[model samples]
Every structure is written in structure tokens, then in C-alpha cells.
Target: MLVLGIESSCDETGIALYCTRRGLLAHALHTQMAMHAEYGGVVPELASRDHIRRLVPLTQSCLKDAGADFADIDAVAYTQGPGLGGALLAGASYANALAFALDKPVLPLHHLEGHLLSPLLTDEGVDFPFVALLVSGGHTQFMAVHGVGDYVLLGETVDDAAGEAFDKTAKLLGLPYPGGAKLSELAELGTPDAYRFPRPMLHSGDLNMSFSGLKTAVLTAVEKARAEHGGSLPESVRNDICRAFQDAVADVLAAKAAAALRQTGLRTLVVAGGVGANRQLRQRLCALTIGKEAVQTFFPPPALCTDNGAMMAFAGAMRLRHGVQAAAPAGAFTVRPRWPLAQLSP
Candidate 1:
């Protein structure tokens, strides 16, 4: 079966074709990060409008890349919930309309589920009952997974997500918006012990985490350095602060992840979402799990770690193979801005 996926949940417009027998055939994406950078964040209205303009063309390009045509598509999958209403609608409307015209089924996918399942698309060793750590711009969550669609929330951030913390802290340092990756790059040049930031709730003894306070702590550090220096904080000092901040986040995440693994007794750890792209976090996670204790660590290639349509297509294909019904014809449906992924089934 062939599934064409559409994703416009945020500032990216992604389209892809996933063939059950052949794997991912084609995928196209346009990130609005640079466009929204001037404003320091995503503009929902602008994001939605851009999706409207890009969806059709992107689908066409994906089809061409796959060497397939609309007639070859068996089903259409689109991100349907847990996103900005307007943005979701853009993809939803297009997917539904196309499915109706093609006389094909529509698959309404949960965005987070796509992220959770992403690691499986490439990693051959991943299996059921993995511990999931999804760290994105908008979400930081841990789940206990037992096979496809069987997800139980283990713990999550109570405030800002890890990616958000990175960006916010970077912003405070005069870095560009959407600065998470940039912040991480700078941290690589910094001395690991030059500064120390708290690892919040590291020993709280529960899965729940708090990162907003961690961000505030970074702000406090920046302020103290500026005040003490009488004008500007040195570049090395800023890099040190970045290093300390990244360390705090990586430590908290790594510690919590190990805890989740111990608590669930799951041997597989799959990291997804944007923040999963962090080199230090990857190093820490690998250091903790790799080549020891039967624990397997899997991460998508950096590009796939972020939001995209390929994961949606792959997830939809998984559902189709498992006998889940395709989405209803699109014009009659609505996006669930806050759907709980655990509510889905395989």
C-alpha cells in the first residue's frame, strides 16, 4: 500500500510518500524557522498560511521524487491533532480533499505518535516495550511503550520543554531565535566544569521534571556575570554558561531517562523530537546505555529528529498494516489540538 503524508503542525510543511513494501519513496519539507526568526518565534497565522501555500506543491514534488503519481497513492495521512488549529486545518483539508478525489482512505495521525514511532523507521534493532524520551520544542515527555500504539505516559515536563529551554536561554544570551542547535554548538567549545547549573528534580524520585526554573537559573547566571564584569560578559564566559546550561539539561534528561528505563525495565530507549539532535545529550545517553546491560539506544538522523511528514507516513503505514481504519473523508473532520497519544490503539 502507498500512503502519502502531510504535516503542517508547526512552522514546517512536509510531504512524503511511504510505500509499505519499498519504505520511504519520497519526502519534501520547508522549514519556516528562518522566516520566523526575525520575530523570535513562530507566528501561528503566518505558519498556517504558509502551509496552505506549500501543501499542494510539496505533494507534487514528493510524488515526482517517488516516481509515483496521485493515482498510485492508496491512502492519505495527515497530522490531525495536538497542533495549532489553523495549521492542522491546512493539512487536514488538503489531505481529505485529495483522498476524496482519489477514492482512497484518509489516515488521521497524531503528531506525537509520529515522533514516538520515528526511530523504528530506520533502526533495525528497535522493538516493543521501549522507553521513549520525546524532547521537542513544545514537549518533553517520557513514555513506556509496549508495541505499536501502546504508549503510557511515564513523566513529562511541568513547564517549558527542553528545546524551549535551550532556545529561551540562547535568546537571553543574544543568540538568534530557534537557537537550540546553535546553543549546543557553542557549548561544545566550553569547559564542562567552567560553570555549574542545577539539574532540577534530578532526585525528585518521580518522572515529572521542571525546566522553566532551569531557564531562570541561566538568566540569573547571565545577570550575575554581566553585573560583575561591569559591561559585557566574555565570549568564553558565555560559552561556559552555554556549556553549563547544556550540561544541566543533558544531565537531567539522561538521569531521568535511566530512571525511566529502570522503572519500566525496558531494554530499549528511543529518543525522538528536535532536542534529540543535541550532540551532548546523544553522547550522554549513549554513554549510559551503549554496549552494556542489554539496553539499546536509538535516535533518528538529526533531520528526522524534528517534525516532518516521513514519520507520519511511516506511522500511518504501520496502522494500516495493523488493521486500523484510515481517516474519514477530510471535509467532515476536525483537528484535536490536545489529543492524548496514549488514547490511540494499534
Candidate 2:
């Protein structure tokens, strides 16, 4: 089947074409990071407008690169929610409209399901019945994957997600907007033991996690540093703080992931979403040894780790193959602004 995927969940507009028989045919994306950076964060109005401007062109580019035309598409898949209402509407409306025009079915996919299933896009030999660690800007959770559309929530954050903590703490340190990646980069230059941060919920005896307290701890440390340094934090000190924070987050995630694997008796761990691209987190997961056995870990390509159309396309294809019916018609469709992954089933 040929599926055209559209993703406009937030600051990025992503479009792609996926062929069930040939894998991902082509994809295109336009990130609003630079624009949102000027405002210190994403302005939803601007994001929605940009999605409107970029979607058509990006879809056209994707189709051109795929060497295909609208006539060849069998379905239009799009993110339906758990994201900005306006951004979700842009993609949802476009997908429904396009599907209606093509006289094809529309597949409304859960955003987190896209991230959870992204690892399967690669030939990583990842099978069903694996544990998934979905760490992203808006979500942080562990899920037991039995198969397509069959996901059991293992645990999740009680407050801020790991990525949210990263961005919030980065801003507290005076970093620019879209600070997660920058914070990770700065962490590379930090001394390993220059600072220490608490690992929240490390021993909470559950798969559930928490990062709010960690962010508070970072804020406290920042205040102390500023007070001691005459209101100016040294670059080295800031980098060290970033490192410590990253280390603590990575440790918690790694520990929880291992616990989830043990709980499910699933040796394979599939890590997906934006924060899965973290080098430290990747290293930690790869090195995770649960007792005498080593765990297998999988991750999408770094470029695919963020919100993108390819994962959506691939996920839609899987759903279709698993007998999930698409939306009956494009008219009178609505997007879910807060859908949960566990609510999905084949």
C-alpha cells in the first residue's frame, strides 16, 4: 500500500510517502526552530500558520522525490492528536481533505504510537513483545509492546517529562530556545564529577518516573551559583551543571528501562522519540546489563528520532495491514488533542 503521511504536531511540519512493499519512499520536513527561537519558545499561532505555508510544498516535494503522483496513493495518514490543537488541525485537515480528494481512506494515527513504532522502520530485527522507552518533548513513558496497536503502559512521568526538564533547566541556565539539544552538546564539555544532581524516583520501586524535582534542584543550584559568583555563572560551571543534569536524567531513564525489561521479561528495548537521540542516553542503554544477560536496544536514525512524517506513514501502514479501518470519509472529521497510546488497538 502507498500511504502519504503528514505530521504537524508542533514546531515541525513533516510530510512523507511510505510504500508497504518498498519501505519509506520519500520524506520532507521544515522545522520552525529558528523562527520560534526568536520568541524564546514556540508560539502556537505562528506554528499553525507555518504549517499551513509549508505542508503543500513539502508534500509536493515528497511526492516528486518519490517519483510518484497523487493517483498512486492509496491512503493518507496523519497525526490526530496529543499535540497543539492548531498544529494537529493543520495536518489532520490536510490529510482528510487530501484523502477525500483522492477517494481514499484516511488513517488517524496517535502521535505517541508513531514514536513507539518508529524503530520498526529500520531493519533492526526488532520484533513484537518488546519494551519501549518513549522519551520526548511532551511524553516520557515505558510501554510493553505486544504487537501493532497493542501497547500496555508500563510507567510514565508524574510531572515534567525528561525532555521538558531538559528544556526548562536549559532556559534556567540562560540557554536559547529549543535548548535540549544545546544542553546536551554543552554537557559534552563538562567535567564528569564537577556537580551532582538528584535522580528523582530512582528508588521509587516502580517503572513510573519523575523529573519535576530534578528541575527544582537545578533551579536551586543555579541560584546558589549566581549568588556565589556575583550574579554571573561561569561558562565552565554552567557546562558542568548541564552535564550533571544530563547524567542524572540518563541514569534514571536507564534504570527504569532496565526495570521495565525485567518486569516484562523482554530483552529487547526499543527507544524512540526526540530524546532517544541523546548520545549519553544511548550509551547508557547500550551498556545496560540486567544481571548476567545483556539487553538488546534499538533506536531510529538520529534524523528520524524527532517528530516526522515517515514514522507516521510507517505506523499507518502497519495499522492498515493489521485490519484497522481508516476514517470512513474526510468530511466532518475531528482531531483528538489528547489521545493516549493505550487507547489504540488493531
- Give the winner by TM-score: 2
Q: Candidate 1 on 1-346: residue-level lDDT in tens? A: 9999889898999998999999999899999988899899999999999999999899999988888989999989999988999999999999998988998888899999999999988887888878999999999999998877778999999999999999999999999988888999999999978888888899999998889987788889899999999969899999999999999999999999988998987778999999999998998998776336856789999989888999999999988787665445545878988887778854
Per-model CA lDDT versus the true structure:
0.89, 0.92
Quote the lDDT for 231 in model 2: 97
Model 2 C-alpha lDDT per residue in residues 253-332, reported as the tens digit of each score: 99999999888888999999999999999999999878999898999999999999999999899988877655456676
Clashes of 1: 1
The global Cα lDDT (0 to 1) of model 1 is 0.89
My TM-score estimates for the predictions, one after another, are: 0.97, 0.98
At residue 109, give the lDDT of candidate 2: 86
Most lDDT-accurate candidate: 2
Off by over 4 Å in 1: 289-292
Worst 10 residues of 2 by lDDT: 323-332
